[model samples]
Target: MCQPPAVALSLTVSVLAESESASAALVVPHSPVGHHTDLDALRAWAQHCDVVTFDHEHVPQEVLAALAADGVELHPSPDALVYAQDKLAMRERLTALGLPCPRWTRARTAEEVEAFAAEVGWPLVVKAPRGGYDGKGVQVCREPAEVEPWLSGVGEGGLADGLLLEEAVDFTRELSIMVGRSPSGQAAAWPVVETVQEGGINTEVLAPAPGLDPDLATSLTEGALRIAGELGVTGVMAVEVFEVTRVGPDGGTRAAYLVNELAMRPHNSGHWTIDGSVTSQFEQHLRAVLDLPLGDPSARDAWTASANVLGGDYAELYGTYKHLMARDPGLKIHLYGKGVRPGRKLGHVTVYGGRSGDLHSLEALRERARHAADYLQGVVTE
Candidate 1:
């Protein structure tokens, strides 16, 4: 069985005893990625490795550029990774590329924000250009006064580089497509999946997006591949898109999609591929970054559903797993070994094996996955 190279593991390991084995090595770090001081240790660490890749996009572009200049192999070069790191940059680049995207502009003052909102209509979305994820550093402003806090913070140097304002898209559902690309130019894409969000955090995902239009699905998949190639990305990339449905003159609904955001790593949206697809995203990412031949991304089951286990009222998550496993032996539960905190992602549960065309069967699969996830998170019992 092929496995990821042990040299590229994340630096932060709480369980040192278990992680420090004869086959793997560990490195102590400075600040988190993006800080000037963080690069000092990373430079030293990269000197000994053949190639370096990232699990997240927080590393400062200057640091990545410096590493590349020093002859270190950094997959998905800094130029490509910037789109994932900065929201404003991403919107500008994607728009310039002629990709479908929401109307947006950078707002440095209350006047600029109000002007954009007036032109596009409220409620507008305000987002920090950098260092925001999982619904953090983002807000929906229904009126100009609602944006005063962000506007005031910009003047005080609290909001870095101002904020990004976008016309809140009117969409029917959220979708995501995962694609893997190699330095050698080979690329592969997984089936698009429907993403369910609650309180701005993704709570569940249904693979292949039940009832998705065949033509729309093909277009989105191709769009994901095109974006990866155009950006010169050399790793797995997840493209978050919004599907908009409109009533046609004939009274039938027609759907189109817009590019929402990008994530150049193994994203939560693809976690279902772990047990539901022929090749998991984790393995595909490792292969892409290493420039190895890519793996097949075909689905292993007719349908698959993955539900995230967010930290909830229950702190003793492990205690509930026995009941969950016994209730559904087919459910695959994954825990990250982290302390519980409300709304934090603790882990996820994936359930597969159902006929895709059967709505009842699909709902059953989703319920099974959600039930196990909820039980572990202490959301339900019996």
Candidate 2:
């Protein structure tokens, strides 16, 4: 829920739903994260604003605290948001709550990392406890030497929460569930979606994860809702989970899931909900943030696949869409209206309601979404 370019669409959708003109103010941080945030200007702005919500998690907690002290209402208060802002806090809290998570520990020195690596075995994940997203502050270290550079930078104010080391999970697939909870305690969940990741960025999403076990799906959805309520999270939160396989003592493998991460705002995984669900995540977020009753997050399509359209060589996206619209009229395209930079997330496309069932029909939907995404990026000419 950080400052992704796609947040423009979420804001637009929310504004349109409320039939109100929303003002978007950009706060250019003087430095990356923390005190660099222009608190004085923000405080002045918040004085006139009714409710201040965030699109990204980079806002410093102190800033939020200062605003709250001034009585500026903020959704997903700093108390609940600390979990999303700091991986260490999230891991500690989730684990303490008996929620399933990868076995992890905080490391301030290379020795600590190596010690943990010995227990977890080689190939562990090292992450920045704060200010990390899209795999930027994360690293996979197979051995102690691989963690040297990052560890050297730890301690002091460099790595605010030090370094986080965890066992690199052997997951079957990535799954994400989106849920919205209001201050009134009303909560709703959408179908669990399988996420396709490329370069650590979510590349595509399959709504109602194809071939997902009903029991497993129910468990994930329920677990996500439980997380929101337990964490005191209001507004839409996407719980990213890792679906893993467990073998009982009888040598029978069983499917299970574990919490991997949490986003306290609309996430890329829920982009498909815009066109495929009864109520989109954007609108749901606004409702929850405003303390309104939650929306029904039911899917309107049997098979919906959302493909992220990355910035590519081509720039004439508007012209290319002419051919795309004529080709697949059902394709739902959402562009961020930002200048294209190679490999940057420009926007996403969603295709739903082909009446496709399970894996059989989902492939076509996936391909259609993929092709449209590629075409818009000028990766596919025909």
Candidate 3:
């Protein structure tokens, strides 16, 4: 997330133009999260570049098609990118592909919603078909009345695209599989990791998903690759999956998995790979998009934990970051280079262990990472 495009475009463009490294590059300030980039500006920028790759799914579909028409190569072509841009399309495609997802339907009207709820049961979820992120556009409804606020705005014609409704999953934990693929069809997957979320924002990531069942992990990796291939993905993709407990015929708990969402870009969940893996997601993404040889996706350590640093009450990041470096040299910090505002994602810290000279345990790594993040955000003094 760069600053909102309309707000920062002129300054961002001028800065990039003057930068030595950006001599051949034309830059556009990205639209804020969950909004589409300006099509005309994006087209102009793409005209100067040989190939176009994306870091977010906020570009409009028509913009992608136009770029392709302009003879600029696009990784994750518009046809494949549609699923990531629209949840309804994603659900339909995944279901058609026999991939597991929650029971869901189109919430076109209140009547249709009631009918779907009658089958899926109460406490279902409602989601905007487009432009929702970081907990926005998603809602949990325990009853019918809770849905009106969303549907009321469409007027008499109703929403042609409509909203999305799904059975709220009861998951033990959220897991993400990051995979990189090329147009040549080669694919590599990083170990599945457990993501910790608060208020719909991802706060921490535990790599290798502590004690994850080996067989299940394998299934997730292969399945993620299968999806990437099916979607003709040509860059790193993050498949958000869930590990849920299902009751057996005899009423015993059995672990099962379901696909939650798909992100066709380097995601927050894969940030730990920057420090803990043989290849970082950002590097791998470039390799994939360029159709170059893929890099190894193996972990450098047995455990790695990544914590997000949100802007807190304290505005000065300098002193807190200094304290973190002095206190934990193993911690790696990455600042997004954005102006900080309360609760905004400013940066992230990664810490790894399970080596001879390192923190020895997974919990220790987690604590170390979290403390670094908290300290940087000025949430914790020590």
Candidate 4:
């Protein structure tokens, strides 16, 4: 039998749920919870934990490496995480591996970016080489003129340089596959999820996506697994993909999926797992990092979907949650403790129990999600 420690861990907003898990043991500063990014403070806090992981990709690799050097266990070692941290490096490595990816190039100057655009044509995608998350560092340029501002960067340190440009992918839709691997190299994967993006941000995710062909789902999962293995990822990873309709070499309609981005930890798209699958992403993350046996990633039902409530105005939303629950008591909600802005992920509403014949139409589900979102934004009252 093991006794619980007085304090178990220290974490920023990203690992709030993990910090609260009974298995991990909750630990916090003497002061109340708020944004605390001090490296020294983080190091001291992490030292007390059995192992350390991340909720975001923004942490400095050097800092993580230092922690590892000091005998602190950091999963998905800095070496592995670098691929997720640097956009150019990831694209270059994946390209080298002969993976299917959108045409992309790195630019150190505005002139170079313009040149790349000239070759790829207008309506391009521009991204920061580092420190960009959500929809922050991504820019869709219809012409060369729209490229310079994103190339300049945007943040507290002013515009960052060294950006990457990719040819806009004209795809049917986007999908995400979540892969989880243990430190021992044992791996597991969840259902391929169909992700709906609005304004460059993910607004909803459907598991065992409606009308998803089994072959396509198989291909997506295999691609996700291969990528995780190649990267030697030690924990959970979510691979964002683009499903494109294109002419095959034989010249006929064929469905193709291309890798879009990589996330090294639990992801928003996996939120549906809480109600839809036997093992949720958060629990799987803990198992992988702790070197414990992996759990079954099977779907609990035929289908499940999660809709995110973006923007601020939690007060109104909080007030209406009871009403929503009153109507659909089975709905599962996960709210993040963060200051919300327009298009920011504040919380999510998940609904399961859908099957092939009696499926909830996408629009109907979207309406329920929208009503909740509106209620949260104070646009609607109970």
| lDDT (CA) per prediction | 0.82, 0.81, 0.79, 0.74
Model 4 lDDT-worst window of ten: 1-10
True-structure RMSD, every candidate: 4.3, 5.0, 5.6, 4.8
Residue 190 in candidate 4, Cα distance off native in Å: 0.5
Candidate 3, residues 217-251: lDDT per residue as tens digits? Answer: 98888889999999898889999988988888898
Over the stretch 188-288, how does candidate 1's per-residue lDDT look in tens digits?
99999999999899999999899999988998998899999999999899999999986889999877889988999989999999888888887788788
Q: Candidate 3: where is the Cα deviation over 4 Å?
A: 1-36, 155-160, 250-252, 355-360
Q: Tell me the spans in candidate 2 whose CA falls farther than 4 Å from its real position.
A: 1-36, 156-158
In model 4, residue pairs whose N, Cα or C atoms come closer than 3 Å (at least 3 residues apart or on different chains), thus clashing, are: none
Clash pairs detected, candidate 3: none
Cα lDDT tens digits, model 2, 1-382, are 2223225433322111111121222222211221226788677566655666777787788988998999988888898899999889999989988888988999988778878888888899988888888878888888888888887788744286689888999999999999999888899999999999987989999998988888899888888888899999988899999999999999998889988889998889999988899888878888888787777899997988999989897864788877999999888898766668888888999988666465767888899999998888787888
Compared with the true structure, model 1 gives a TM-score of 0.90
- Which residue runs does candidate 1 get wrong by more than 4 Å? 1-37, 155-159, 247-252
Clash count, predicted structure 2 = 1
Best by TM-score: 2
Candidate 1: what lDDT? 0.82
